[model samples]
Target: MEKKLSFRNSSFLLLFFLCAAGNVGAQVNPADVRYLGKMEGYWTMKTKLGIYAEKWKRVDEHSWKGRTMRIEGNDSTKMDDMRLFLEGDAIYFSIVAVKDSVGEPVRYKLRVLKAVGFVAENLQGFYPQKIIYRWKDETHMDAHFEGKQGKTTREIILQYTRR
Candidate 1:
């Protein structure tokens, strides 16, 4: 069974710590994963918890590597590693945390790829079974994570800008 990364009444901090695939006749065009290269840069957001930062880079046309960090004062903690890759005609999004599964990533398949952004889903995963990305402009983006915990549903959105 998948673990609940965040409880319904708990802070969303644990989510930044972890956080996607494809099929034929699928709305998702795996080729479009390349367009995400636009995300290649250092992005950050200031939150009550501290500074939440993410760095994305293109590994190739078919892959991109990203890392998330939580910064408090002079201390910065590595939260997770996010990866996007294409396999056959499908695209996948994965998050890996050092303490979880010995750094083995949990993946979500790309289910919605749009002009503004995309959506990946792993309905059977943790607190956030869905990862949605939407870009407001060249350097502004919103990431929405959603899932159900018991009888209640939870959603967390993080707005990020070029850092």
Candidate 2:
């Protein structure tokens, strides 16, 4: 037996997923990503690995680019090249390591959008399945990374302040 969805039925499925995700629209909107502008500038946090910083630059109305680096004595080592961009009415957060590979970045789709924060998720990854960012105020922000790895569920929270 063979089955096919009629145009009306297909449209219904699309609407279903869009409503379930609660992301406002299935059609991408530049305005939806405008909140990212609040993150522009440099911020730092102290971690067991040492000091880390994130710098953001608004590339356009639809995107923002960032650098995540580890501070050393006087120089910093770039850990990742990150981007938040909109495509087809949806927002995506992507990160690629600062290595020669230049392979595909790990990407997460915006699943929840709110006034001060948003939740992005990658269903295919074994670890870091979710990345959450929130602006606590003009000078502070929180970043949360969570996922299941090797039979353990892990979540790391980092609080950064303007530097």
Candidate 3:
């Protein structure tokens, strides 16, 4: 009797899991996974600011994603935390601008200041920054960075193309 009851319980658990899986919406599909996969590659960058190229790599399966960007020539200066979440067809991202200093990382959170024509944002902190990006293609992008450092406020426009 115990053996029979155990088999029945196992069958019920299997059926419940199958039904639960079917009901969960927004579960990433094969094409979504494919698009996510395609994001991993080298990207060429052109900007009025100073820094040149940015390399992107898909370092996660879902939920939390990470990428690293290093300035050309100088290996010392690098920006980390290019993280984003996927919702429908749009990708939402937040990156902390950490100076290449030898000490602890300085954190900055980018928030949406406006999204009228193209999405734009004023970063949250004492030293605030604004960032805007528009999709050039399915795999290409262009962005603008503007911020205040110390007593100076500066702006830069940059292009990013996936390779």
Candidate 4:
């Protein structure tokens, strides 16, 4: 049979659990919250696909400038330029072909669906329906893209580090 907890014992156990969970009267200063936004900056990543780089800067209190570059293959046979904007509660990341040619960057738009410090969830207009961003730390993050459309499911993982 389960033993019933005494009133005092139950109260003590509840207090203990709250303390152990680190949720006792926690506080976050507004200044500290704003400080989290400082993470905006340029970052680069070395990858088997290419040298992928991005720049993020605050354009205003509620907007940001985002730029991306990709140099593909050892010979740098392919390059792309992408520029985007992040407004309060949303993002508009778009890919643009820097040069007109076959296999040029296809212009497309991406939107932010969710976000937290250093972490963001985005959806591209193309096949991929979901994107995840996980910050390894203040200077690094990992991104995962996954999608399934028309019998095709593609996924790409990328790492980004502060430049």
- Tell me, by lDDT, which candidate is best: 1
lDDT scores in order: 0.73, 0.72, 0.45, 0.47
In model 4, what lDDT does residue 109 have?
Answer: 26
Cα-based lDDT at residue 154, candidate 2:
75
Judge candidate 3 at residue 71 and give its lDDT. Answer: 59
lDDT tens digits by residue: candidate 1, 1-163: 1123333432232232222222233467766776687778998988777888889999987899999889999999998889989989888888774122445577888776765677788877766788877666888877777788678898777788987
Q: Roughly what TM-score does model 3 have, to 2 decimal places?
A: 0.45
What is candidate 3's lDDT per residue for 1-163, written digit by digit as tens? 0011122474445434433443453232323333444345666664334344555566556434445454545453455555545545444445655432444333322222121112323344333355454444566654555578778876555556876
Model 3 residue 137 CA deviation (Å) reads 1.6
Q: At residue 83, give the lDDT of candidate 2.
A: 92
Error of 3 at 145 (Å): 1.4
Candidates in order, TM-scores: namely: 0.77, 0.75, 0.45, 0.49
Q: Write the per-residue lDDT of candidate 4 for residues 1-163, one digit (tens) a residue.
A: 0112233574445434433332333332223334335447877777666677766666565445566667666543323344434434334433453222465533322322212322122333354455444455778755555567568777666567887
Name the top TM-score candidate.
1
- In angstroms, give how far residue 160 of model 4 lies from its true place: 1.4
Q: After best superposition, candidate 2 residue 107: deviation in angstroms?
A: 1.8
Candidate 4 residue runs with Cα over 4 Å from true position? 1-39, 72-125
TM-score of 2: 0.75
Superior by lDDT: candidate 2 or candidate 4: 2
